[model samples]
Target: MRSIAALFSMLMPGVGQMYNNQFVKGVVFLIIEHYDNVFGSINKAIHLDFNGAHAEALKAVDYQHLLFYPGFYAFCVWDAWFHARAGADKTKTAIIFLVGGFLGEFAAIFSTHLPIPSLTCGLVMVIPMLAGMFIFRKQ
Candidate 1:
């Protein structure tokens, strides 16, 4: 059961915890990170292009030769990696971090309306892991 939470974290960062019954934490992350990151990036995409087709046609994002779409790929990996080495409370911790991640991204989104919720959510989610860090450190 705990492993399932960790696995979900790996797949979507905070999804594991939410599924594990950490609804509050899960909602926080979803709102904070995923919403903002995706929206923010897409918002940028909309503005970066002069016409709809320009942004639409540019299926690839290139910033100094680095190209990647904004999503849960990295966070999923992070959640999995960290959770793998995590303790018994990995699921609980995943939920909190997921919440924090969501909060941070929500802040960003509300401030700029940039659609950065998704990317920011992933980046900020690890913050709530402090709870897990404390939990693990106690042992």
Candidate 2:
């Protein structure tokens, strides 16, 4: 069940929360995710920047709206996973998730300035996040 919820979240942020019967949170996640993806503004900026359209990409980027995406996405996944586990401990879960989500958001913000590929930076951020998840896992 936990794995399924996690997997569902991987597909889309809120589905796992819905699976866990967290309808309100799931809706919030879905709304945020949809807002991030619908216009694809950030994504378009990234794509354009990657393709060497720096000025156009800068014009396309919407920092204010983009900031909400990473944290929300990460939080929903972590929240859903915790809820999925039958006897999961809540201790420190929020902190661990906050750390992970912030790191992810930082990566997203830095990707534009850094010479490294965004995907690579995202993968780098995931290492610590995965480690933290394991480190804080229910015993």
Candidate 3:
């Protein structure tokens, strides 16, 4: 159940909350997700990034809005996982999300130096997140 919830969130931010019976929170997250995507040009950037148009991808992104995305994404995943876990120890979860968020932001900041700057942020961010999930599952 917990893994399912996390997976739902991984697909879309609010879906897992909805699965957790948090309709209002889920709706809010959905709104935030849309807002962030549009303002950040995240979809456009990712498309360009994957197409190897690194310059265009960088130009497409609105850094101010994009910068907030990693933390928000991490939080949504953590929220669903926390609820699904039904009061699992929060310390590890918090640490995992926090680190993921920070690393995501850090990667975004330094992505300009990488060959695939736009995609780098997402890749770096997801690494810790997936690792955290596996770590939690083992406990």
Candidate 4:
């Protein structure tokens, strides 16, 4: 159920989508995070090669990076967990996030490409996250 997605989302960002019966959204988060992790490892591997630990250089990418994005991943998963435990209307929560989640996800995505600071993308997401909480925060 969506509750499952919320748990996954906490860890992988968009995992809650799958539980919400929204695999496409889940896949989007999954792919993006995967891509980022892969590149980060590649960077570490290259960094280590230069340092002369050629054989085990690739091991520099801490084991944590292998499964999740660390801080961001944990934050997202926790957010999902709280949402799952507190939701009053899973349907509305699902709908709002399924659509608004993209704005947040892609914004965070695009934000990475930016050279300066901005909160537009985060604001887009926070609004919905808060709305989801409000909607489900018990009548």
Candidate 5:
């Protein structure tokens, strides 16, 4: 159940929450995720940057929304995992997830400004998240 929930949330952002019967939380995650994707212009920026359109890509970035996305996304996965696993304090776990998510957003903001390729920037975003999963993982 834990694995399934984590995987589902990994695939999207809120699917795992829904699987765990967290309808309101799931909807909230979905709305936040989609809002960041569209309004943040991150996807568009990434696509543009990858295609060698540096100026256009930079122009596409909506930092206000983008900065909030990484953490929210990570938290969704963490929250789902906690809820599915059982025997965990939901409120406490959620607070931890929120902090981690914010950190991820900060990393993302920094990575974007660095002199690195888009792929590397993506790695910068993912590597810490993967490491964090291992670090915060339950036995």
Candidate 6:
């Protein structure tokens, strides 16, 4: 259940909260996610990136909005997982997401200089999250 919640959140920010029966919270998250997506031009960037127009993708991004995305995304995932677990210790779970968020933001910030500027941020963010799931599987 916890993993399912987290995975849902990863796929779509608010869905996991809905899975946890937090409808209002999920709606709020969905709104926020849409706001970020539009302001950050995330969909456009992703489409451009995947099509091999990395430069255009990077240019399409609004750094101000993009910078907030990793933290927001990470928090949604963590929140869904935490609530799903219902009283599990938060420290261990938090550390993984915090690190993932940090790395994601870092990658986003420095993406222009990275090998694959457009994809670096998402890859950095998801890698730590996936690792966390595996590492804390028993929890």
lDDT of 3 by residue, 1-139 (tens): 8878877997899999999999999999999999999999999998998999988898999999989999999899888888886658888777887888898899888777888876678777777888898888744
Cα-based RMSD of candidate 1:
10.5
What candidate 4 gets wrong by more than 4 Å, as runs, is: 1-3, 6-13, 22-24, 42-59, 62-68, 85-139
The lDDT values for all models are 0.46, 0.71, 0.86, 0.52, 0.72, 0.89
lDDT of 3: 0.86
Candidate ranking (lDDT, best to worst): 6, 3, 5, 2, 4, 1
Listed per model in order, the count of residue pairs whose N, CA or C atoms clash below 3 Å is 21, 0, 0, 6, 1, 0
* Candidate 6 error regions (>4 Å): none
Worst lDDT 10-window in candidate 3: 85-94
| TM-score, every prediction | 0.33, 0.74, 0.94, 0.36, 0.73, 0.95
TM-score, ranked from best to worst: 6, 3, 2, 5, 4, 1
| Segments of candidate 3 deviating more than 4 angstroms | none
Ten residues in a row with the worst lDDT in model 4? Answer: 111-120
lDDT of 1 by residue, 16-129 (tens): 657666677666666655565464454454444434344342342232111122224334433543444435455544555456545654543442343443344435644455
What lDDT is reached at residue 9 by model 5?
88
Task: Tell how far residue 134 is off in model 1, in angstroms.
Answer: 20
Give lDDT tens digits, candidate 5, residues 1-139.
Answer: 7767866987789999999999998998888888888998878988887888876777788878777777677777777888887686666455555655666665566754655434555555455555555555663
TM-score of 3: 0.94
Best by lDDT: 6
lDDT pick, better of 1 and 2: 2
